[model samples]
Structure formats: structure tokens, C-alpha cells
Target: MKKIEDDIRKIEEEISETKIILPYGVMSITLFDLEQYEKIIVNINREREKNQNLEFRKSLIKKYKFVFLSKKRKLNKILNNLKNNKVEFVPKIESVVNKEYLQKFHTYREDISLKENSRYFLRQRINCCINKVNEELFLLNFHPSLYMNSMDEYIGGDFRYRYDAEAIIYEDVNILQSESHHFAIYTNEKTKEKTKRDILNILAYLNGTPIFLFTQNPSFNRKIDDLYQQFDLLDMLRLRKNEYFKEETEESISLQLPILKNYNNYSVVLFKTLKHAEIVDLYHSSLKQFEPLPRCVFLYRVFEYAASVDYKVKIRPTEYKQEDAIEYYIEKAIGYNPNPLYYMDFGSRKVTNYFTKLKLEARKIFKEWSEHPYKKSKTRGEIIYNIGRNLVAHGGNGEHNMKYDYDKNYKHINDVNIILELIARYVIELLNPGLKNVVERRKIYYEKQYTL
Candidate 1:
């Protein structure tokens, strides 16, 4: 009976030491926390080294024909304690020495395999979620809050103004951050109609009466087919290695006469010849002699022209007094030169005179509001207007210019738009006072046009 018991103990010992056969390429089936698993891998490596040493020692012992006993039983007990303590297994095994011991080992190994597969699946799902969140954040970053708020005003309300808009998308490719916004103003149908009407009115006022005949053929008449043929012939000749021949051939050719197209059908004359072609060409050449002129130069010229008109039409006695009052102011605002020939000779100077006259006319109308005691108290528009004028005249830091620092007060489109609105309002008041009803009829129009 003791011999049978000893045999059973030996079987149990061998079973405990044996490794269970797992799925193909499967090395381990032990379930452990991250730290525990790391420790198990380390132990496995150490045991493998120790086993090699033991095998070498066994070889020496076998050569001497000496009996040897292993301390494996003690090591197995320690390994069992490591596995069993603070660790639980699912699909539990009954005994290590049973006939069904290998089957039980397979069950535990399958459980560990499934657990590992589940961990991998969960990690992938979490990663997918993170990627989706990042994509949404990237898209949202492009649509800035400020742009959306501005767009809301135009998109909503009775205006229902849905015009074509272009946005330049600027972003950091590395960090996925948007940086800038730029927009272009386009003429809508309403704006186009208003511009046409204004142009016709100005033309009528300038030419004594509204001449519908000029509107019929507003643009310069030119035969497109003749121009095309001339261009093609010139291009073909340009490729030839004979400049003398090309010049001689060009001189001999006669261009077809282009019939003038009448623009009488349109309500407004869309084109004008302010200066004769020869004079315009001379003016262009004079402008090219200087660096590009500032916007104020153009504004100054407009003002000069309006002043000239005031000189011609002495209709408004108030305008005459205003003109005398503002003449010195305009001259001082811009340094005056007395050479009439120099003014006439310089195209940029002439353009400057025209723009300045227009601005002065706009300002004169705005100043009329100051006649009322209540209007005089409101200084916001007046202060901004003065700042804008100074900015245009001097090319300084605008309202932001200070002793210690420069501030760009008009940092946004809305701020600049407000200044333009005030200027336009003043212009309308001066040009068409009867349109005061048209201007005052809509409170929302002023808000939409100028709010910052």
C-alpha cells in the first residue's frame, strides 16, 4: 500500500512539473496583472538559465555513475504558491495528476487566450474613439467663432442676403490650428442697381441733363474679330527671326473699322471718357513716374474737384460759407503748393485733388448735423472720423497711436466698415438730402452696416 501511495505521489509531482500543451505558438497561459505578468516573464528567463546549469550538473553526475536527487519538488511548491496566492483562475482544474489533467489544462489556457484577445479588442476600440474625437476637434478649429457670429447677422433677418463668399483657410499643418480670416466684398444685385442709379445721376448732374443716348453705347466700340485676327497675326510674326520684316508687315496692315455699338437700351451710362485718349495716356505716363500714391491722395483730389464745382455753382449760400470756412482747413490739412502748372502736370497730384474734394464734401454734410444742440453732444462718430482723416493724411497708427505705444484701433473689418458707413452716410446726406427718408426708414440697416 505504501509503494502504491509513493507511486501516486511521484505521478502528482511529475504532473505539477509538466507544461500544458497550448494552441500553436502559445507560450504561456498564466493569468496575471501587468506587474505580475512582467515578474512571471522574468522568472521564466531565470528558471531557463538555472535549468541549463542543472542539466550540465546532471551530465557530470551521470558520467561518475553517482545517484543524484533534484530540489525540483521544493521549486514546484514555490511556483504553485506564486500562481495560487492573490491570483484566481476561471474554468478551474481539479488535480494535476488526474487522467483528465491535460484536458483541464487546455480549459485554463483557452480562458487566458480569450482574456488576452478581449484586452486587445478593447484597446483598439478606445483608440478608434480617440481618433474620432481628434477629427471633430480639427474640423471645429477651422470655423472660428468670430466669423460665425458675423455671418449670422447677414444670413438671418429680412435682408436674407446670401451672396457668394470666399474664405481662405489658413492652418498649421503640424499642430492643426487655424490662424487667419480674409473676405472680399462683391456687388450684389441690389448694390449693383444702386451703383448704376448713382452713376447715372452723377453723369446727368455733370452733363447738364440725363442723356439716355450715351447710356445706349456706354463702352468703347471695338471689333472683337478684327482684334483677334490682329493679335494672332502679331503673335505669328513675333516668333519669326526677323524684326525688320515684322515691323514693315505690321505697318502695311490696315485694321478693320469697328462699328460703334449704341448703349441706349440701358437706363444708365456705364462708361465715360473723362480725359481725351492722348491726355489720358500722358496722365498715365506721369503717374508711372512716381511710386504708387496713397488712398488719401485720391481722396484729396476728389475734394478739390468738389470744391471746384462749388466755385461754379453758387446755388447753396450755406455751401459758400462752409467752403470759405473749410478752405484754409483743407490747405492746412494738406500742405498747399501754389504752382498751378505743377498741379496740372502731376497726374498723382490731380488724382489727390479729386479725392480730397470728395472727402471734404462728405465731411461738410456730416458737420451740418452739429447745428443741432443734441447732435453736437454725440462725439463718437466725430472723434472716429477725425482719427480716420489723420490716419489717411499722415499714414500713422490711426487711433492706436500713443506716446509709448501704437495701437491698431481698427483691427477688424467691422471697425473699418463702421468708418466707411459714416463717410457714406455723410456723402448721401450731401448728395441727396431727399434720400434722408430712404436712409432713416431702416434702423436695422444702420446696425447691420456699421456695428463693431
Candidate 2:
């Protein structure tokens, strides 16, 4: 058993190093053993009838039958084959990477045009010290792998969830060079997270797209109890294109093309960059005159204030069984003094309606990200954000399992970003005071409720 495990590990290491020149390179198909293979086919056929992706479905069935079928059997007894050994102990890998279904780009790897090379992409601004190290880092595969050999302009990765888009030496770039003594590899796990965050931020920046992080570092998984500086988060979030505005809201007139819909196709939570030029196009050319960082600085301060108050103290009521007592306190606190820290900087007189509006935007974004099927319109996203903001503001409670899930954390990161940027815009307007009536246009759901 040990020898087999060691051999498997060695193979995985070798496979990790091999560059996947995808859409052009061959894909391995079928992984599970014979009995499990038959069961998978049976399970797939059941699901295949439900989805509208018939062509994709048919291709899978054909591929599974031809190559994956280790011991041949008639099609009729597939359900019977699945009946026994239902208790799955260990699911083995099947070489089921079907190329025909995965590949998208028209051009081959070597065939590239000069125009694509000049594509406007965001770049990572790495510091001098960390930039000097030579160790392999990767972008965790958050979405389906895109084809087209644009490694000069973009990075290529395996067509699997959480595969590393490896960091390699490219044109003698100092950051890409591999060194024996990488700082992240040697450091105690807690300190290694900053390095891990930097790598993902750089890749996400360069792509001008949201790239998720999944690294060997244990610190990232441990879940910190207090507020700490995350690596270049604001810059990465800014790259997501027109994130707040939805397709319908923009009155966008374009036909939606059906992407290669297969088993691997997943939902996207995008982060885009809005260039100064894009800001001029979407909102106003006047915004170009005001600097971006000042707004970001103010927003950072807002987070500092949110963390100051103790919103997590859930005391029981004296009179009765207080299962819902914490809920009562939270409701009262938000209605009376939603965020005391928020009022400190911008006086209530000047920014009365603005804070209310910010909460509404956070709720809206939160709802969209959460996709919670069951309805609860009463506790809107804004209220939830305020509560979370207060709880998180107090440096997050690690004890009593106050930690957040991965998906929820990612959604919150994006949602809070939307709230902060919107507020920043209003703050900038406040400084000028020239656009009083115009800035009022940013008002949404909350001010209607709070701002009398």
C-alpha cells in the first residue's frame, strides 16, 4: 500500500511539471475502475435526460463506452451493475478528460497575431525583495481553462479545478526565476500567507480577472481571528469590468452566445478593472480629474471603524427563553445607530442619507452572490452587511466557530468592495460640493427607508 501510494505521488509530481498546450494537446479520458465506471455511466444517463445540452451529453456517453469500458457489458444491465458496492470507500481517478468537449479557441498554439500581443492588460507591481526569488507559484483555476497560446500576453493552466498556472522564467524576468530559497517555502506557515496572497494578486492583476487562490500553505486555511492586511486586494477588485451594473440595467444590446456547455461549465463571480478611460465612458469625464487612491484610503478607514464596535455580544433576555435575543439587540442597534464609527468622520448633517444608501447597495450585491433559494426579504443584504461589518470590524470571532465559508467569504469580499467604491464616489462629490443634486442620483433603497 505504501509503495503504491509513493508511486502515485511521484506520477502526480511529474504530471504537475508537464505543460498542457491545451486545445492542441491530447486529453486523457477515463479514471475509475471497471465496476465504478459502469455505475458512473448509469448515473450520467439519468442526469443526461434532464439537461438540454444533448450534444455534450451524447459525446460523453460515446467517449465513456469506447475507451473507458475496461470490461465490456450490454447496455441494458447498467442500472443492475450500479446496485451493489454502493458504499464508496475510495473513488479512483479515471482518464476522462475529453478534448473534443473542452477545446474552444480557433487558433493553434504556435499561430499568433501581433494585435493580440498589444491587448491592454493590468500588470502586477511586485516589490523588489519578493520579486527577486525563484520559486514556482500558481493561479488557482477558478474557472474553465481558456485555449489559445497567448502565454506571452496571458498565462495557461490545466483544465481542472484549482490547478496551478505555474510561475516560470519568462524572458529573464526576475520574478519568474526559480530559486532554491523561496521565502514562502521556508517561513513559518502564518507568515507565508502574505507571500501566497501576493502571487494570486499579481496573476489576477495581470489577467484583469478574478483568480481564486488554492495553495499548499496551511495559514490560508487556518482562518485568522483578527483583521490583517490582505495583499493588494483593492487593486485586484478594481480590475473587474463594470461589476456593480448588471446586463439589463445597462440596456446592453448584444446577443448572448452559448459557450461550450458541458459538465465542467460553472457559474462566474467576476472582478474587472475600469480604466480611467472606461470611467470617463461609463460615468463622467470629470471623475478623471479626481485621484483614485484617496477614495480607497477613506474606505479602508471605514473598515477600521466597523471593526471597532463589539457587535457580536449575544446576551440572553432575563424574562424568557432568549433564543432570539441577539436578533433583538442587532435590530435595535442598526435602527438607532447603524454604524457609530461611520458617523465620526462624516458628520450626520452632511452624510445622513449617504450611509443609508451604502447599506442598500451592499445588500443587493450580497443577494446576487448568495443565490439563497428560500426567500427572506425582511433581513435585506444591507442589514446583513452592517451586522457582518460590525462583527468583522471587531477583528472576527474565531472562538465559537465564527469563521466564514470559502464561497461566502469570496462573495463578501466582492460585495463590500462594491459598497466601499460607491461610497467613495459620493465622498469625492462631498469634497467638491459642486455636484450636490447630481450626487443624490446615487441614492437607492436605504435612503428611501432611513433618510426622511
Candidate 3:
């Protein structure tokens, strides 16, 4: 009876050891935490280097490789969730080899003839939540007394409103008496960047008016709080490529209903034809500036836009191509010395005299350019671009004889300011000729009214 008990005790010890003999040698499976798996692999590698037995190495590889591969797949599953930023419960490394993962590894390790077919299925169901969110968000850009005929019209996906439910006229935050109208665009885009881009594109169409301020409010649902946003004036100004002037009030332009309505139609055509839409926004915004420096920069942009399209403007490496284009356009379209009254007329003597002075000073500046290396002819382009535009744009660090000083060059830039506006208007008309007749009639009407 004592001998039988000893035999049973020896059998139990053998079972606990889990020793198996292969063609190479004896191997044992040690029950340890998953953290020790790396040490086991290292030991195997160290032993492999010492043992030159080919069959021994093959046996070790066949036995351990299957278990290593299974554990690696399970570990990757946990890592993938973390990589994708998903919150999930992960098993501790100590518990992995002692628990569920260990059982799977043991099943594969123990069964040398085990045939496992791993089939993985990954499915994604995209939720179409368009209807659940606000389908359209509208940005209302406000400007003072736009003089647009009261008309609520939908143009393609973008909607324009003079007075409507969505386009409510808001009182100017700074000025009490001054009320402002808006050109609103409705789109499904929710991101702030996309909304701003859409607003800019629509504002490009309203080049006839000055749009400096805007507000965005999107309501996804009534139950939740809405997001209200406004683009800060300083932030928008900072985005400008060249320096710009900021004024409290916009210098509003008055146009008849038919003329203003045609702006809508002409904008549609311009959107398709105008390759560089940024120049359009820059041109119109320059008109409302209190200072002249920004206007001069915009005037140069006008010439650049003209130069890009008109092949007749001879391109020279040393010469300013924009200035050349400006000269070419003025001479071809409205003569070198264009009368201010031909484009717009003011009832006030002071305003009228200011414009008259602008034209005379332009001629004087033209003569000054004769001494320049290029010696450009006495044209509107010569004074506006080569002289005024260059002085403000290039004059930095108090250089160019301190020409960048606003007070110092006020007279020169102010004169350039008036001429540039007219030139900008002329170029715009030249490019978008659809509203040319209407503009001409309005100019004639203003001229007659001022004369009377």
C-alpha cells in the first residue's frame, strides 16, 4: 500500500512538470504571467545560438512559434482599440497568461497537429444623420445702406435677400441712426472654415457694396443651445494679403433698383468667368477705407488682374506689368485723361472740387514719371500704379524718403485713391460688361442732377 501511494505521488509530480520529449530534446511549458513571455523568447533565442542541432532548433521553433503567434494576435486586438482612440477594458499582462488568453495559447501549444482557420469580419455602418442636424446654415453680412432694391430672390443654392425673415436689418452696434442690410448665403456646411469660405465667395458677388461685418448662427435643434459666431473685424483684416484701412462706417454707393438688381445677374456671370475672385473683394473693400494706403495696394491689384487677362499688355522683366496693363486698358477704353464726371458726380462743391483736384494731380504725377527709368507715358496707370501704389506698397521701415508716412503722402495717396476707385470700377465694367449700359445711364443721371 505504501509503494502504490508513492507511485501515485510521482505521477502527479510528472503531470505538474508538463515535460514533453521531441526529436531535439525535452521541453517544458512553464505556467507564468504574460509579462515573462518576452524572457522566454529571449531564453529560447540564447539557447538556439548555443545549440547547433538542426532538428532541435526546428522542434523548438514549431512548438513556441504557434503559441507566440496566437498571443501576438490577441495583444494586437487590444492595441488596435487604443490606436483608434477607443475606450475599452484591457486585460492586465499578469492575468493574460493565467486566464482566458493562456487557455487559447495552451490549446494551440499542446496540440501539435492543431489546424486553426482564422476568419475575420470587420463591418462599418455609417449613420446618415443629415436630417437630424441643421441642413442649412446662413451667414448674414451687414453693410450700411446698400441701396439694393427690396427683392427676395433665390439664386441657385445661395439665397439673396433685401428684406426677408432670414435677412433682418440690424442696427449698427456703433451708430444708432445707421441701419444695415445683409447679403445672406445658406449652406449645409457646419465647420467654421467652410462657412467663412462660403461667405467670402458670396461677398465676392456683392462687390457693388461694402461688407465689413457679419454674423453666423446655426441651430442644430431647438432643444439644444445654438452656436452664435461673428468674425472679428481685426481678424478678417489680418487675413488680408496687403495692408488695409479700417473705418467705422462704410461709404455707401447709391444705385437705382434695376442697376442693383443687375448686380445679382452680373455676379453670376463673373463667378464663372473671374479666375481670381479675391481681387474683386479687394477692389470693392478699398472703396470704403478711410485711409489711402490700402486703396493704392488695391489699385495695383486691379492692374495685375488686367495684366493677367489682357495679352496686349507687353510683359517686360524690368517693367511693372500691372502698370503697363493699366496704361493699356485706360488708353484703349476711356482715354489717358478720363473726366471724373464721366464715371460719377457729387452734388457738393467740396466733393466735386476734390475729384477735380484728383484728376489734375494725376496729370502732374504723370510728368514726374517721365524722369523714371521706364519713362512711362502720361497715363492714369503711370501716376496710380508706378507712383502711388509703389510708394505705399514698397515703402517699409520709413524708407523711400519716408513715403509710407500716411500724413506725408496723404495728398498723393488720396489722389490715387479717387483715381483708383474709378479705374477699379472701369476694369470691373470692362470685365463684366453686362451692366455697363446701366452703369453709364446711372452716371449720366448723376451728372445731370449735379449740373442742374
lDDT top scorer? 3
Q: Where's the lowest-lDDT run of ten residues in candidate 2?
A: 117-126
lDDT of candidate 1 over 112-175, digit per residue (tens): 5443342333233334433433332333344221112111001100111111221212111110
The runs of at least 3 residues in candidate 1 whose Cα sits more than 4 Å from the true structure, single-residue gaps closed, are 1-262, 265-272, 275-297, 311-385, 395-408, 411-452
Give the number of colliding residue pairs in candidate 2: 22
**Predictions: Cα RMSD each:** 33.3, 25.9, 27.7
- The local lDDT score (0 to 100) that residue 78 gets in candidate 3 is 34
Residue 313: error of model 3 in Å? 7.0
lDDT of 2 by residue, 1-452 (tens): 24333443454444312122123222211111223334544554566446534244434444333322222321112222223322111112113222233233222223432212111000010111112111101111221111101111111221112212222211111121113222111112122343333433323322222333224454652332111112222332332335533334432111111111112122221222221212212122111112223223334343332222222222323453221332343344234311111111122423223235444555555566457564244343343344334434454456523234434443444454445444334332323232223111222322332334
lDDT of 3 by residue, 1-452 (tens): 24333443454344212211122111111321233334444665676557544445445543344334433443344335434534211221222223333344334334321111000101010011111111111011222111111222222212233223222221211111122343433222122333334344333333232333332322332111111111111221222212333455433222211122222322211122333445565664454343556657766676567666543444543655555666666544434222222222223322132223444554555565566555554555666665555666776455454254443365456555545655555565566543244322334444454445
- After best superposition, candidate 2 residue 404: deviation in angstroms? 7.3
Q: Which stretches of candidate 2 lie over 4 Å from their true place?
A: 1-378, 381-388, 399-406, 434-452
Query: Model 1 misses residue 336 by how many Å?
Result: 32
